[model samples]
Target: MNKIADYIQTAKLESDKPFCAFLYDLDHLRAHVQARVDSMPANTRYFYAIKANSELPILRALAPIVHGFEVASIGEVRKVRSVSQDTPIIFGGPGKSDEELIGALEHNVSLIHVESMHELRRLNELCAKRDTVMPILLRVNLRGPLPTATLAMGGRPTQFGIDEMQIAEAIQLAKSLPHVKLEGFHLHSLSNNLNAAEHVKLVKYYIERIKGWAAEHDLELSYLNAGGGIGVNYADLEDQFDWDLFVGGLQPMLEANLPENMTVLFECGRYNTASCGYYAVEVLDIKENHGKTYAIIRGGTQHFRLPVSWQHNHPFVVVPSERWEYGFERKGVEDQQLTVVGQLCTPKDVLASDVTVPNLRIGDVILFLYAGAYGWSISHHDFLSHPHPDHIYLGGDDHV
Candidate 1:
């Protein structure tokens, strides 16, 4: 297992990762998974959510290891089908068309997560007409902080889930429909400050809620679906999440509350695959303004582009031929502020503001750190005039 430290060391020595590099530290990511899977009780399942980072290598790495795949669109559904036929498939996202629903049904996937009453009702009607029992998971509107915290994303008005007020009525509808099986409930809080421990807290909370609700409605609950917001901190490598501590914190709770025969399902998309991609591009020129210097790279927001996301700046690194003795400055000197801007026509094309690198030169390539998640896929403009950077998948048993 290559620790983050080992990856960094090897990268510094290899000398080949110069043009552009994302440096997917999946070795660390998989170590996190291995630690958790080892501790999790039987029947607990993890599903690699496809939206976060859907590169083929990332999918291939996760497919053989995870219990199933969770898809939000027919395109994602097709991606899963291309990989493994036996991999349990779960479909999600709102506004799925009738054709999409029909396709999902045709695939005989494990479950479909529905967001609205209209969708639920429509899916029920379709299942009845087809004379097939469609397995369904109810997405709840959990807002704010989840359990173990006062605020809630597992608690109201969350657009992704059905409103809390609608739960009982939906259940009644399910009981009478005779076609949709209410397998379990699902919740997803965006990437935030939670590790395996907080995730387990959510699971335990759901178990109690599901059990209590099952008793009230005289229903049998056989599944528990937990939302995926697994977070990966790329800026501070040492701040890497401790998956063992996380799994240790939740394993006992899950073992205690999970109903017998219930399959615990996890939807993890980003954290699972984000570490495996690398985006590389060469520097086109360098410009000097006042006392500051800037390196204009061939790729900008039009290519491997990511600026501030979720209100945080993305990680990036400038590759220098010689090892520098002085540390890289996080902020520029009072008179030396080199703002890196993308080549796009819009002013919003700025990539970083007031960033100081290794006194960048014309031919130096600036490598964006942890760019595997979006890189060329999210940044390229179909309408732009700039040439697109080529995407590559460096093969390794360990995710690329």
Candidate 2:
């Protein structure tokens, strides 16, 4: 009956399984987003980038509160479409086809973040046939290397936007076409900014550039979108956020240069919606081998897709119950180093390489921390044929 050997001695347990819950701190995410929205000087708007985590329940929770959505594909556009129509959805990507453009415009989407002249002509043909003007914000490549070497090297030389040198030409083209409005200027740098200073630098660059573009062209800037690259707190740093400073970093530039009545839009994904989620998993087996104990969890990289992409570094922790120690005792004897691994075919399928844990018997619950941003569906894929993880919205019911 020693506490160290009992399985789970707690009373308020939801299930007798090791859970894979991605704890969503949505309020915090919303607060972070709203703070950015409210602190802006003038015409500024925000579009929650939905690719980070497209959990339905998570999107359901956020859709009503957000100003708009930034979708990269037709599927994502459809996702937002099913929820709300009033919330403007802007579709942005480099390889969109005529069908996708038609779908977006069919829904009366707020904006099309256009990448090329061919697409502009296509939109003109599509809209002229439909007798409508498609508002667009040209994505310009402003990714001129960040301060960090690793992150700078992490980004590929991509032409996702209308390159900066083509700005004036793009504007002239937009006006001459008669079917598209050059509504705003959009520039999203790569997401590897190690700090906020570079992001601020980007915002300042946009403000100055947009100001000059608008003044020279008499375009009357309506929207100035500062693209999203807000880093998350997956690093486990004690002070994960520098909120006041982050908000302050771009606020001054926005306050100084935004055009009259223009809404500044932000396409934040991980920053606005990632932290407010939890991934629950059940422990399948525990064994000691070669001086290293392993906690093999049931799910694989197919369920949590980031491991396959090598864009993952999430933290894992046990849900703290009043009788957590007793729960561990019921499982086994002494605490040990538990290297958590997935039921994946590849030898590299590791959730966490090394973790200290109270001796866990089969079926003890494990909670992964900071998994809110990009956990399950974004984890890994190929061969498992597993269904995507079920989203369990807290303050609610059993999703499975």
Candidate 3:
């Protein structure tokens, strides 16, 4: 049997209950992460962005590979600590509570990326109470135009980081603070960028801009954090962000231009974990509506919301079923287009719209690809009181 058939057979044997199984190939995930880690320059560090896929198994598998983790919330910090206590971690976000800051200090996290002037002061105040100097990266929203990507977090006015225009003053203010040690800068702006060359340019741009700022201020920075926005091409499977080309371009640039003392850290989230996962939902009913075919599955956008959020058609494969008990023909539409929807009553609960599929049937399964990263966590699970999907890890003797 093929991979799709194998997954469907496994699902059938594991549970008679209705579920959407999120299958992960840990071996693939390990190799993918290791390849990136191996390709990084000597001065560059690789940190897995936990926001991508924080599942315990995923984190556990990556603990032995990645240099450390980049987390946005205190919960994430706690989660990482639970998995591996010794690994380095960097905490960053737009809004962090005083308790969270204190927790980070108590735990002695590797670094914290200060998002704003107020947050800088807040962190300083919290650090003063502990009588400890906290290392920080001034998260800068660059002054120039944002990089071309599906989502831009910086460049324009947003809640992410301190604007580039005010960095000098922020640095000056940090100098006065006794408890906060200003180390470097963190620039993370774009997401889902398909162009590998453009991402390389963005990383170089960050380095040069930070070098200029450091020269003007007469500061000795320790690291320039090229925050993770490295993207995956969901639209075209064949067209991807060429990792080998990206690493090839980065190696020469860093060797020639990067300051010897300053190390660069890359916090990759989506790009690292996106490809190792697959979401499989069984087709419950197939019908024609308004001259269009719709395959209503046991789950919907509440479970897997990436398609709706991106407003793009998600790619899926049809797993054919041989057991048809009814005295009638199998309900299917071959070579034609159909919309895949969930069990929810709302019209917004669509997973794919007008996508091409071959020989789809009611008893068959629809395996959604490229669902490893944002599929599990980003969805609104409580929209309806449906049972959660069963998260199944595909590889490893202990997990399968």
Between candidates 1 and 2, which one is better according to lDDT? 2
Query: In candidate 1, what are the lDDT values of residues 75-178, reduced to their tens digit?
Result: 88888888787789999887888888888998778899888888888988888889998989887765434644222454644457677667888778877777
Alpha carbon lDDT of residue 212, candidate 1?
74
Q: Write the per-residue lDDT of candidate 3 for residues 81-150, one digit (tens) a residue.
A: 9998889999998899998999898776999999999999999998888789999999998876657888
Superposed on all Cα atoms, model 1 deviates from the true structure by an RMSD in Å of 5.4
Q: What is the lDDT of residue 324 in candidate 1?
A: 27
lDDT of 3: 0.86
Give residue 350's lDDT in candidate 2 (0 to 100). Answer: 75
Decoy 2 TM-score against native: 0.84
**Model 1 worst lDDT run, 10 consecutive residues:** 324-333
Best by TM-score: 3
Model 2 regions more than 4 Å off: 1-42, 143-156, 192-194, 215-218, 289-291, 311-313, 320-335, 358-361, 380-382, 386-388, 396-400
lDDT of each: 0.65, 0.67, 0.86
lDDT: the better of candidates 1 and 3: 3
